[model samples]
Target: MYERQNQRHVPGHTFSTPELAWAWLRSEQTLIDRGEWTPPATRRQEQEAQAQREAETSTPFGAYARDWIANRTTPRGTPLAPRTVSEYHSYLEGPLADFAGRQLADVSRADVKAWWQRFADKPRYRHHAYAFAKSVYKAAVKDGLLDANPWDIDNAARVVLQTPKTVRATMINDLTPEDVQRVADATQPEQWQALVLLLAWTGLRPGEAFGLQRRDIKTSYIDGIPCWRIHVARAVSRSRTPDGIRVDTIGTPKTPESIRHVWLPPHLVPAMEDHLDRFSQPRAEGLIFPSTNEALPFATTQQVAGTTGKQRRDRTGGKVRPPSGFNGARESIGMPGLRLYDLRHWARRILLSAGMGELAVEQYMGHRLPAVQGAYAVLDPRQVWPVMLRCSDLAGWTPSAAAPAGRDTAVLLNEMTAEQLAAAVSAMSPDQLAVLVPTLSPEALVRLLGTQGRP
Candidate 1:
């Protein structure tokens, strides 16, 4: 019997022999001496706790992981994005499938190592799976289901899969203003021209651009200058459903930093106005870039089949054919591998080259800055307008010249002698010179200034 706090409890187990009872009594006395004595009821409670822990540890890892993902929430207390949930499901079904039958406690470091080896040819997927597994194991440890996390491989989650040198070079290749114009001109249906230009100039993600509504575009006067701004509040995300059907979900932008007002360059304002007038719906709530079915927003992978007049008249269904997409436009312009995302890089490069501060460029591109700077740095439209004007000039963009007919302005500027350039530049007004100054090299500017001082 054990007694504590005026309560007495008897042991539930029966002793088989005198020696066994005496040994148990000795152990209990030893526990008392060490100040570790507990009443019989308290011991029973501890035994129940041990049993519960055992049951939790014995839970199958796959089931635990699925449950963890299902209950996962963002830092803002919102459910995980649908695309994120789908990606986690893919990790479970693909690389982590081998652990389905194994108990949580049975997953050893050796098992993880062996599983990781299978993805030798797919380092990107391997890193993602390793991260997911680490997160799940971390949760298991927190839940008291595991004593320690088994994903102890050093730097396993830090693996940086490098792009091929050739591919990397191609990806970073400078897209000249003429090249962008060419691709936009080559883009079929004519309606997509503004989209191509917007992506290239504004550095908007395709999803964010597609999620735009007429109301998102608003005109603001900055120091008496009319500035058109794209208010990016939402984005369209594509994810595969349980049945493997791809669907688009319109939601908040990728991050809080992505929700911003991107200033439209003066040169592109006309194109935007044209797009709104011709392609976009008249309603404020209607999508700026809707699919052929105007009721639905534009899908990232949507391709409408083109039908000939004869096929339409036949009444027998026209053979489905792929429409000429961005791929066709790129191929037509002799850039077979140029991705639409690459246009964002072009915009960043142009802004940086025109002497925009890194923080300012990051703001323009809707990219998050370093932690301390991100919290404090604010982009003023007054400051952005001057830099944008310079960037527009550097990009060879003219408000009146939407399409280039003669030699490129950049080419013309390059061919002219310092004296000739000075003569030509002197004819321009103060605003034109302000726009032209950032585009000229220091050496060229010095020479032009020297020539201006001469006859």
Candidate 2:
């Protein structure tokens, strides 16, 4: 039979005989006369619905999850980071494996709940796996493969796991400069001593430090006193290829805010200079903390393509490993649980104690501040210089009496605290006062004269 739809004749199902075709045509015409006629496309749609239902029943969760990850991208339309993709796959194979063999439509809330119990002892893993599964099922719902997501266990994805207070205290609050020095001294081969101190003093993430080149370190003169600054532009990222080869990529820093210039405390500068003199490569572009191996010291992007040079051919070496003796060093210093990252926390504490403001601390630590505040907060070297000097004193690295410009009156004036400044001015001779008077602003001079009972 045939009927017109959208001004085009649409053919219907065929019959074996003329009589059957005639009967079918008559019934369809009656329906049309009564305004109950449905187009042939309705049957086609029913068939399509049946096929979709069948497909949903047969499509395994494992296959769909893999595809989802393979095609996933960030909101900005960039492909997911290699490490993030790897991590999601790990979730699929590990905690999410129970749902893999089951059909996507067959995964019920009960199944999810029962599967979740397996991770009762692993809270962190539970959190990650739940988040991964939730994302996958969310995609399934959007794709019309599932009517509703089965991962509806309340708070399963929103749970926040907190580190124990004792661990937090040890990692941040209880750490001391003496402990930092002890760990630095304990690093094997002595070359890593500078690195240990740098981490504690500058608060650089290990990846950021690893990505540093000689050119990233620059000397700036603040009020005629030479100071050192580290320009953090990139960081080392590690990911595995499909072939299971681990590749190290030197790319942008963790965040845009992480691309910052941090003033190096004077005490830390000497150690950094020493490190450069002894260990840095001849070229400015060469890595400051290159791999210990003589060949392929810096892990370059070329390494990701399995590129090999004569040096690499001599012996295949992996990316730079963590500094040797770190575990033993922490233990030797009576802090068995001390991690390298704890040094970052120690650095933050030192900065705060040295009278650096919250905004300045955040800037120095490469942390993103609130939008309005961040835009207006400028970290000037003049402001940073005094803080660095104070940090040196707080960290027990005060310049010695014999150190160059260490005891110079000009340098001392720059480093003095407000109370110390007042005491020094009170003790100044008339000649010294005369020399300092011209440098004071009008407001300051007026205040000084008024305090001295002068009109």
Candidate 3:
């Protein structure tokens, strides 16, 4: 029950038969077993419960166990999310299936513990499986199928779960822009090309990119130059249903801020437009990078033992072939360590190197501000466009791409806001400021001073 609660599932189910209902009650017995459900039993209440207990103990535990899982639903009342329901089924089939047919009265605490010892060497599974098994017995007691839950014998608070050995945090492989470009070149599919460049260049999360639709990408002007913006609102996920079929699911983003606009640089716009022309769905609400089915993104194909499977996902630590998945494509390009997500990291580093500010980073990356800052500042897309374009230029343009010789830097100083001027001045030490002021031309000094005093 603790594990289920910890996993965000609300535990309760209705059963068809009194016997199954009793076992179902036993499975749900978590609250009482953990001392979270104790209520004083009045004389009449205790007597009535005792009577019910005697009548129900003869029922099979398996009867209720099956219904407990089968009838259970998510809080949203949909069929269980595929992954979640699948885990429950695995537990029931692997460890708890047989217990179903056994009479509630025949089970003992010692028997339950001995069964749990099977996983003692596997601490991780034992801890959770034991907790789940123990809850069933607890539910039995509460349903009047039994007078007491045996697993609670001798005041044992929980199953003795083993702890695994501790280890250091693993480091991720971060790719460079060159590495990202190589993977894009190696990829044969035009859509994957768009997908790879989309993620690497824009720093979008994989699911966020997968969720994008035609209506999400729009043209915007930055400093009078046109660029594209991607409004990310959702992501697509895959789940396996109870009968063993995989299906796509769409849900809320990982965070509220994740529903944000990502700025696409002018350089990548042509490839994007080409991707739309070649692979995009016809309707406005259609997918930008749809799978063969035109709903989810295409699966990463994999070679197997004389066969193939769409389920395989190639990442940094794998071998690849010509028609191989994302990983395979990167490996084919002589840059094997490049994961799609690695491009996101590269995008961030390149943008920061290109002179993007932290505030702009937050918007582009869809990161929420710290609590106090979030309370005070809501991002405005119009306000963020200029910084995004500057960062985009920084990431894409060569040093030689700077403004023409006719443009004057000192004149541009007058365009700086007071806040920008204050930040610039704050970055300079007194000695540096004094030395810098003396070297400035009179006209430049006036422009600088005027900018500093602006409202």
**TM per candidate:** 0.73, 0.74, 0.55
In model 2, the runs with Cα more than 4 Å from the true position are 1-59, 75-77, 97-102, 158-167, 221-226, 293-324, 400-455
Provide the global lDDT of candidate 3 against the true structure. Answer: 0.59
- Can you write out model 3's per-residue Cα lDDT over 1-455, one digit (the tens) per residue? 22343353332445567788666457557655886653323434777777876667777776666565566665547554544556655666667666667787888877777776665576656556556667667666676567677665343345442221121111123445555666776565556777787887788877677678899988864323456888899876665666766666776565677788777766677788898999888887878877754353433222101112233444765645234556666666665444466667666665555445566566568787777876876555443433443444443432122222112222233344434333433433454455445554666556556666455
Off by more than 4 A, model 1:
2-46, 153-155, 158-173, 220-226, 242-244, 292-296, 301-324, 332-335, 399-455
Model 3, total clashes: 9
By summed lDDT, which 10 consecutive residues of candidate 2 come out lowest? 302-311
Better of 2 and 3 by lDDT: 2
Backbone clashes in candidate 2 total 0
> What digit string (tens of lDDT, one per residue) describes model 1 on residues 98-143?
8876899998998888877878889888898889989999999998
- Using lDDT as the measure, the top candidate is 1
Sort by TM-score, top down from the best? 2, 1, 3
Overall local distance difference test of candidate 2: 0.72
* For every candidate, C-alpha RMSD to the true structure in Å: 8.4, 8.3, 13.8
- The best candidate by TM-score is 2
TM-score of 2: 0.74
